[model samples]
Target: MTSTALPRPPIKGSRTQPIVAGLVTSLVGYTSSFAVVLTGLKAVGASDAQAASGLFALTIAMAICAVGLAWFTKRPITIAWSTPGAALLAGAAAVNFGWSEAVGAFIMTGVLIAATGAIPWLGRLLAAIPVSLAQAMLAGVLLQLCLAPFVALSTIPVYVAPVIVVWLIFLRLSPRWAVPAAMAAALGIAGFAMGQAGTTFLVGELLPTLHVTAPVFSLEAFMAITLPLFVVTMASQNVPGVAVLASFGYKTPWRASMISTGIGSSVAALFGGHAINLAAISAALAAGHEAGEDRSRRWIAAVSSGIFYILLGLASTAITALASASPTGLLEAAAGLALLGTLGAAASSALSDPTSRMSSLVAFLIAGSGLSFAGIGGAFWALLAGLAVRFVIERKRH
Candidate 1:
């Protein structure tokens, strides 16, 4: 009979394993969520060209930041665009935050991130915000995007079903690539549809350019976009990223990392991007043993991924063009698949503690309800409502 024992691994990791892992890390990171970023930016009033520029800017900024951090610390500290923050933007865009106002909000978020590192008490304040509410808000913001697949399936099954089927097949076979595979399927369909439509592309359309906008700040945008974005990025990406790396026996340079990402975010905002932050998912990919057995040398994986990011970024315009041509709901279906895991995690966290369950539920409902008042978005109101409910209930019990 054939033995069922697992094969032994090499005593020392292969020199090339880290390189391969790095490539996979970037591939997964970019393919998995670029749709979300594009959708979010466009929902907030960005034109097709502007949205492409935003994606390119974010990709390049994260690449530079990741490379710099990994090279300096010799640790696999990955950087990424704020995926959750982008979703939050998607949800908030309904409030009609003009593109210029959104750009200003992005700058404000960048400043807040930098302040968290430069000012100690500020970080503490942000950390002190209840995790339950933060998670609840995130879940709520993701509600519509996550439901997009089923909606698309109902309305446009002819186009979206194949994408979902491919996603399901990959989800079972290789969960890491499920969303990317779905994205690929969607892209193929989009490209074919484009061919049928005889879409023409010029050489300039293939290259990305910056869509610089002078930021126009306002209190409404700050309250509606900036605070919620910063909170989501920090609670969901930065803090968890640090914890993720710490689990792998590496300490992230918190201040430096924050400052670098903050500056990168600000610069990218001027060019139509939202935010960048420490990476949670990609961080694990490069820091894990799969990257290399020699922990000290795993930083190379992060650097490799950063290099890949730069190259992938160059293709943003072409990719955006393909996405722009996709049949209605196709990109949404793809984005919804990409966000399923995140929605599940956020929902679970939001309801984990019984004490805060009702409060979090309040937040969840309010945010998802798309409630808006005084020209502010549902997410901001949701947080306030949740906090108020928590306070009232807790005080009475105390």
Candidate 2:
């Protein structure tokens, strides 16, 4: 009698599962990044179309590099929009630059990122960041984003809160289904109900309009945009992103990650993409669940996510169309709610380690404060405060 083949080791979950997970996570990642880019461009004197172009570049670049790195590493290496970096760019641009200057800044940022990645010592230094501090940094980066759903509810409760609640409940029981289900439900409910009620939400177009602005090379723009951009990407985005990977079982060398990020940012910037970095929250999505059990197959998730991001970038018009099709409240609420799991996970990790608990909490609070000075955001301060506190404590003990 032929024995029934036992179920193959569940080394990898459903092949499609990772792709879907990546897509959901990417939706949030890309949208969050694009929002900052779009608004930033507007604030910096870019026309609507120019802003869209910048966003288009960013999305396409993120997709290409993220997918490429993930494919190369065979790990869940996701790319993100560099939210903190964008904020810095926005403030700097508003103060002293036009679109050309902004593009120049973007170019400088790309070069810096690429250089850091190529340097051997930088990778080692990144590796030395404490696990708890890394986790705290991750939490700090994501804090505002995670809270946006409830914040949205404050402005539009009827449309957003219900959807958020339903999505949260769905997430608890069937996380795999939660994102898509939330997305579908949010759009269907909000679009129809809001349409009948005759309210408008700000959802952009699916196909993005391309606006090519020549880059103006200037020392001032370079200093303002590039230097700060690199700092934030390293401190706010990549450091925490690496930490997340380390927190999980994947200890791939930092050289590849840094190199990929640097190269991706540089290449993307040439085409107007703001800055691309390793995804922290979205990486958690791919890393968590059964999709992550097999390191080899996990690369597929990142690859697929990159493909989706590139497609989204290319079809900016189409992306805006799809997003615009949904009610604004619904779309924002969906992204905000989807990130709920990641927010909770990072927060837990940050505070869980006994020795670093206070320091981590301090980091989390400072990062979440949303304080900015001279176009710089709280990420730098948060890291500084936490590091200073940790140093003092360590010194005293010794």
Candidate 3:
């Protein structure tokens, strides 16, 4: 007698791995860069409460935008706080603009970002920027942060060595887990240090508080802070972010992403946060094959990341306390480790083409120099220099 063969069981899709990757990616992205945001806010005259509130608001806003956009487009569209813009704010803080004016500048920058999506000419102008120049500028912006690991090693070897060791091992065994492992190492070290000092590692109001700052606009703030912020967010953050998705074969809706981030940034500014934009480095984590084997299901990664971000925002007070308790060099080391891959990718992309080599190098050096002119940051100057060089040199060949 022949026995009838039972039909094969359907394979169930395993979402656990992708979801975990998303959560870890979100946590690393936020923790690695939140220090920069806080420092920038304080530099611009925000009180401790205001700075913490700003972090909470920014995280919540970006979480909403990331989830909404990823669901709408069915793509892993990750949104992030503008780390370069925060760095720009840190530099502009020395210019004496108060927190109110900084908030006003944030509003204006958001308006400009939104306009880029609505206005065809503006969008085209941004899109026309050379890839090499944009990547060079990003490399320049990330250079200082990426050097923090080395500096931390020199300053606090005991705290940094374990972090570096763990990061290196994980990077070799499982590259995706490297940054998270490094972050955990840092937290452990910080906790031990706090214990030695007789201080609590996590002590703060668990609830997030909202603090609204009335924006007061001025030409100085606009020129020095707002315009530069708009330029950098668009060039260094949004442009590369779109490119990252495209590299992973995702057809991103550029206008929609820009508009959503613009609105999110505007809302965040009311509570003292700066611009929110597309995630460049972290986008790869959510959009790549690691998220899921089925491309259509990868949006889940972004959605999960958004959920994690909201939870983090709700715990902003505790996060702020933890950050304050950590050694300065330790936090910097974690951030630096997180960004090492990004720095390498940017450098390679910026110098990839022989034709744009000279112009790209010029942009990189000028942007890395941290020079300022008439309230404008070095990023804008670098772009201008790169464009001028490209025109003069490339035109002659034609």
Candidate 4:
């Protein structure tokens, strides 16, 4: 059983802090990375309608998961869409197939995630994978996306510069709010440009809608999307999320959390979402002392955060429209800035293991190279090449 901090009894008026903490958690989590999520969906073949649907689907699914799992496990087990996996998707080499195949890959990824929880050996196998290599793959995937802000400076300095300025200012003053501040500034730019262009949002587009597609399985997509997506989400989000909660004295109900997120991911894939998993970077807001000193009451914060995300889902279309209206590099700069920290962390960890350094470097190089073979993408090749190098290095030692 998971160790949700046991409480003496319910205290009057103690709920207020956790409820507000939940609100802050959802607001920060959603604002910080929605651009990356939308960009990734589009990169993988989602049309505007489908991408909005995917955003809505992810928000709602994870919200449901956050509420359900928190109630079931009575821990601050917040759920979030896999932002790093979305970055991987954003950096993915273009595929020959379309959205339906991407959806199929999402389904397979969900199955693999659930299998990791349900089947004992699968989780062990994932644990056996070297951490340096996994992080190297992630760092490689982030390289191009992280470079977007600098690239924008050369081409569209007029539009992207202010957003970066806002981010830098906040990075010094309040690092937690840096990306969201940049996003708000980017949206402001989009709104101002819309006025200059004399363009008005359609009343209908302000509301969200679901656009479901029948999934189509393909071997190339499985190789290109599914494996990489699964590995990245597990390595980056779910595993670290558990660790974060553990640091705060909560033992996440592992099997239940995995099953809940995996099922949520599968359901969301039909509506065009790529994937959702345990909240990684954003989990602390709800679980931390800011929520309450009464640790047992912190699950209240997670549940309320889920409710807030469901409300946020209502604006998926509006946000998508606003972002699509923005000057291209402006929105991209926001996404890139949001990922910069993660890139630094992953790169640092990837290089930390001295013996594994060569293999990690190989993975990082190959993944960033954008090489493709027979329709499969660079990410798959990067992992394979890194593993092969690691094997040879170990054999030599023997």
1-398, model 1: which lDDT tens digit per residue?
A: 78798888765656887888789899999999999999899888888999999999999999999999999999998899999999998887667569999999999999999999999999999977899899999999999999999999889898899999999999899999899999999999999999999998999878978789889999999999999999999999999999999999999999999999999999999999999999898788999988988888899999999999989999999999999999998888889889999999999999999888988999999989888888899999999999999999954663
Candidate 1 TM-score over all chains jointly: 0.96
The model with the greater TM-score, 2 or 4, is: 4
- Ranked by lDDT from best down, the candidates are 1, 4, 3, 2
Clashes of each: 0, 13, 0, 0
CA deviation > 4 Å runs, candidate 3:
1-9, 14-25, 39-47, 87-96, 200-206, 243-250, 284-297
Instruction: Encode model 4's per-residue lDDT on 1-398: one tens digit a residue.
Output: 78887777866557698999899899999999999999899998998889999999999999999999999778998999999999999887466778899999999999889888899899999997888888899999899999999999999898899999999999999998999999999999998887888889779878999988899999999999999999999999999999999999999888888887898899999999999999988899989987887888899999999999999999999998888888878777789999999999999999997888998999999888887788887888989999999898854863
User: Which prediction has the highest lDDT against the true structure?
Assistant: 1
All candidates: TM-score: 0.96, 0.66, 0.84, 0.96
Report the C-alpha lDDT of model 2 over 1-398, residue by residue, as the tens digit: 68997887764456677888777767656644454455445545666556667778777777777777777767788888886666544444324557677677787777777767687676566555665665575566566656667887878777776776767787789766666566656656645765776755344543466666778877656655665566666766777787787777776556776666677676666556678888875677776663555556766777778878876677554433334455554554565555566567767877987777888888788767665555445555666678888898854654
Model 3: lDDT to the true structure = 0.81
User: How well does candidate 3 match the true structure in TM-score terms?
Assistant: 0.84
How well does model 1 score by local distance difference test? 0.92
Query: What do the candidate models score in CA lDDT, each in turn?
Result: 0.92, 0.66, 0.81, 0.90
lDDT-best of 1 and 4: 1
- After superposition on all C-alphas, the RMSD of every candidate to the true structure, in Å, is 5.0, 6.1, 3.8, 4.2
Report the lDDT of model 1 for residue 122: 97
